[model samples]
Target: MATDGHGGLIQPRKVPNPVRESQSHRELHRELLFSHSRGILPRHRAELPRVLESRRLRQLREELQGPPSDLEQQLRKCHQRLEEAAAGPDPGPRPEFLLVRDSLRKMKLAEPGAWQT
Candidate 1:
């Protein structure tokens, strides 16, 4: 028995059985993907924000022989998408659409004359 934070005799935490843990993780991944495909998982609820951030960061790190353009706008759009996702309920199914939109926005920003008013 493990003592609780309050000094109570809390039940011993069961160590995760390796096989069970693996199976459970796989199940969870599958469920996440399913929910995303079904549009049940909102963009903010899913991993889109993290993925977009990572991509944007990577792009920023790449050497640009030309001018420093579109990066700020792209980042801003990513931030907006994240905010929108956070503001809305889980968009079950079609989470990919959010990702696609983010990608397109980034690409557009990358293109010359694409970031016009």
Candidate 2:
């Protein structure tokens, strides 16, 4: 991560010397930025957008901006998981589930049961 002149953490940048960064470190940085932009150093939030809008993020964004292959794969996995969840049976009963049930009952019987049910 780079820092602004005021010592605030800025968005992660491509290492000025790429040779100094390991592949794992680069991958980790990419994931951190992509997954949770807010989770980055708290101070970075203020500096990030400015840096991103500036030539710095633009240059790096152009070079390393495409969705990482890992993210694409994870997204696919998430879709698959959602599909599975939708297709699968509910795991079990939940009490809060009855809140909506009760609301619908009230709506259906609004005239007589509005206050009773």
Candidate 3:
């Protein structure tokens, strides 16, 4: 069983590395810019008219770069997890039982027939 800094058997959460995340986003943007310049739009990239593409590029240039959108961030996190899972030891038989048991033990519900509708 795995132990944490607190000496508990609970599994430790995987933390995303900011350096790796920034590298991933940089690569994505570089690829998009290359594709745009070459007029080679991959199916996954959103289709845009030439005018819109120019506008988007300008907007991208102007905006003070901030964190990625939620969906993009989520995809990055999932990719990180997949890479780690592929390279690391298999987590056989996850301790789902412990989770369920803990949840049930703390279960709380409103009174029956609390709603008349």
Candidate 4:
């Protein structure tokens, strides 16, 4: 650890540090900047497998990628159990299971309907 004359810590470098960032991050950043004309599309990164990131980097990029937290894991387990138990979509036959149509429903409807009409 470098320190100044008054025993204060030295200022960090203004340049990017390899130690502070993973290789994937640097490569992805460059790729995005180089492809700026594409307008920040998610499909652009689909070719680059994001699994290469380290746990710390992944944590830092939680919005993009990371292993679920304890609470999320527990919730996922509970959700799985509920799904497995066939407890969903039951009781007097609900209407559409949801009050509103979301992306999933839109995507499903976007395809041809199963009916012969």
Question: What are the lDDT scores of the predictions, listed in order?
Answer: 0.79, 0.76, 0.77, 0.70
Q: lDDT: which is higher, 1 or 3?
A: 1
Please write out the lDDT profile of model 4 over residues 1-117, one tens digit for every residue.
656675885667699777549989878888878778668665655544545445557668886766778999999899999887796655665467464556566767777575337
Candidate of highest TM-score = 2
* Per-prediction TM-score: 0.21, 0.29, 0.24, 0.25
User: For candidate 3, lDDT tens digit of each residue in 1-117?
Assistant: 666676786666899878757978889989989998998777655556666888988789758666678998899999999999899995776599987887765553443355345
Q: Which 10-residue window of candidate 3 scores lowest in summed lDDT?
A: 108-117
Quote model 4's TM-score.
0.25
| Model 4 alpha-carbon drift over 4 Å, by segment | 1-21, 38-40, 43-79, 86-117
- For candidate 3, the TM-score is 0.24
lDDT of 2 by residue, 13-89 (tens): 66577553779888877877875755656455677576666877678876786766887789989999999999999
Q: Which residue pairs in candidate 4 have backbone atoms (N, alpha carbon, C) closer than 3 angstroms, thus clashing?
A: none
Summed backbone clashes in each candidate are 9, 0, 0, 0
Model 1, residue 18: what's the lDDT?
A: 81
Where does candidate 4 have its weakest 10-residue lDDT segment?
A: 46-55
Off by over 4 Å in 2: 1-68, 96-117
lDDT of 1 by residue, 3-94 (tens): 55767855678787787569788898889999888877645565877788789887877655444469977988999999999999976776
